[model samples]
Target: MIAANVSSSHGEKPRKPPVKVLSSQLREGKGSAVGGGKPEVSIRRLGSRRPGSSGSLAVSVVWMQGTVLEAHTDQNSALLLDETGNFHITGVKNIPRGKPCLSPGKYVMVMGVIQSHSPEPVLRAVKMADLSHNAAMHRKMWKYEVEDLQQTLPS
Candidate 1:
C-alpha cells in the first residue's frame, strides 16, 4: 500500500499578479498608470510652411522667457528674441497690408498645433493673443485667425 501526503496549508492568500492597461489613464500619461488628458500650453517657437493659407497663421521660432528688443525693420522683416535667442524672420503671415507688425515687448500668446520634423519644432499659429501687462506663465487664448484678425484690421 502506498502512503498519500496531504498539504498542510490549504488556501493561503493567493499571490497577486500584474495587470496591464492603457497608458492614457496614467497620472503622467506614461507607463501603465492612470492619467488625465489635459492639453498643455507653453511658450515656444513657431514656423510657417505655407504662408498663403487664408485661414492658418504662422509665426517665428520663439524662445521662451527672453527679451524681445524693439528693433527697427529694414526690409519687411521683424526680429524677435526669447530664451532660446534672437530670430529675424518675416512677420506673421496672412495679415492685411500695412498692419503694423506686432512690436517687441508686447506679451503675446501663441496657439496652434505642434509639429516636429527631424531636428526642429514648429507651431502653426491658429490663434494669437496680445499680453503686455499680465506677468504670468501662460496667456489667455484668443479667437481663430480669420475671425479675430479680420475684426482688428480694416478690410
Candidate 2:
C-alpha cells in the first residue's frame, strides 16, 4: 500500500506553502510570523509595494490592528487608524455575524490581503475582531512584541 501511494503521489505537483511576511519586510519578501519572524506591521508600511513590482509580497497576507476612525456600513468599509497612519479597510460585510461592531473608536484586528496601493493602501479584510474590551493592553503588548521581533532580525 505504501509503495502504491508513493508512486501515485509522484505524478502530482507539490504545492508551495504560503509565504509569511512582516509589513516592513513585505517588499523584501522575508519570512512569516509563525516562523518567529516579523509578523505584524504599522499601517504606513502596508502600501510600500511599488507599482509594476512583481513578487509574492504584492499579495502577501497581513495581520493588522487599529482603531476604527469611521465606518460606512452601507459601503461595507471603514477607516482604520493605527499608530503610524490611517488605512482603508474593505469587505466588512463579510465579517461573521455576532462579531464585534465596526464603529468609530472601536479597536479592531483585521487579517486580510492588500487589494491595492494606488492613492492609498486598501486592505480587503478576510477576518476581523473587536479589541476594544482591552484596547490599551493589547496595543502595548503588540508594540513590545513587534519591537522584540525587529531586534532579532539581521541588521
Candidate 3:
C-alpha cells in the first residue's frame, strides 16, 4: 500500500500560506478545506485508488485536515489549500457572513467528493470545519500518520 501524511505543521502552525500542489501532479483523494466552525474529523491523504464502481461520474468522499495554503472565494465557489494538493470547492455553505473571504494559513477540516477518474479532481465540499483551535490534535495526527506511512513503505 502507498501512504502519506495526514496533518501538517512547522514547529508552530504555518504563519505563511500552506503549500500549493500543481493540480496536474496529484493522483487521487488529496486536498484540504473548511468553513465557519465545526468539529474536526480525522482525515488523511489517500495512497490507493478506489476504482470507479461503475465507470465515469464516480464520486468519492474525502475527509482532510490541513492549512489553507491558498484560497479564492467568489459568490458560490472557492479553492482550498494543498495538503497533498489543492481542492476546488463548489456549492459550499457558511460564507463567513460579511466578507465571505477566508485567509490562507488557517487550519481546517474538509469533507468533500471528487470524481474518481478525473486527473485534476475538484473536491465538492459537503462539510468543513476550522480546526485551528485544536492545533495540538492536528499536529499529533501528523506524527501518527508518518509512522503509519513508514510501516506501509516497502523495504
Candidate 4:
C-alpha cells in the first residue's frame, strides 16, 4: 500500500493520502480495511457528487516532463509530451469553466482524476495551475511506443 501525506484542503490540517484501489478490489469490497471503519470515499475516490467525473473512482495524475508541441488559441488548447509521449489538453474539455488562457512555454501542473475508458486513460483536470519556473526537474528517459502515439494524436 503506497501512502503519502498531503494537505488536500490546501491548508494546515493534513489529510490522509488518497488510496489507490484496484478497480476489481473496489468492486469486491477490498477497501473495507483502510479507515479502520467502512471505506469513506470522497469525490476524489469514488463519490458521485463531483461533476465532469461521471461518478467514478478518481486517481491523481502527475506528469513532470512535457513540452508544448502545439497551441491553438482559437480553441484554447495545447499538446504536451513526456517520456511516454504526447497528450492533448483542450480548453473546451480539459479546463474548468471560466478559466484563463493557457499559453505556450509554460509548465502546467494539472491536479485531476484519471479515468480509464479502455485503451487509454483520460485525465479530467479539476484544478489546473502553473508551476513555479524553478520547480521543474527534467530528466531523459526511454521512448514510448511511437506508432501507438500516432494513432491517438490529432491529424
Per-residue alpha-carbon lDDT of candidate 1 for residues 120-144, written as tens digits (9 for 90 to 100): 2333333344555663443222212
Q: Candidate 4's residue-wise lDDT over 24-140, tens digit each?
A: 222222122133232322222222233342333322332223455566657655555444445555442456631443556655554433332122223444556554354345222
Predicted candidate 2 versus true structure: per-residue lDDT over 115-145, tens digit per residue: 6533445677778888889999977676555
Candidate 2, overall lDDT?
Answer: 0.56
Alpha-carbon runs more than 4 Å astray in model 4: 1-65, 72-77, 90-101, 116-121, 135-155
- Candidate 2 accuracy as TM-score: 0.58
Prediction 1 TM-score vs. true? 0.29
For each candidate in turn, the TM-score is: 0.29, 0.58, 0.45, 0.38
Top model by lDDT, which number?
2
Using lDDT as the yardstick, the better of models 1 and 4 is 4
* lDDT against true structure, model 4: 0.38
Q: How should the candidates be ordered by TM-score, best one leading?
A: 2, 3, 4, 1
> What is the TM-score of candidate 4?
0.38
Error of 1 at 32 (Å): 34
Q: What is the C-alpha RMSD of each candidate to the true structure, in Å?
A: 25.0, 11.0, 13.5, 13.7
Candidate 4, poorest ten consecutive residues by summed lDDT? 141-150
Model 3, residue 120: C-alpha shift (Å): 3.2
lDDT of each: 0.31, 0.56, 0.45, 0.38
Candidate 1 stretches greater than 4 Å from native: 1-67, 71-74, 96-101, 110-127, 139-155
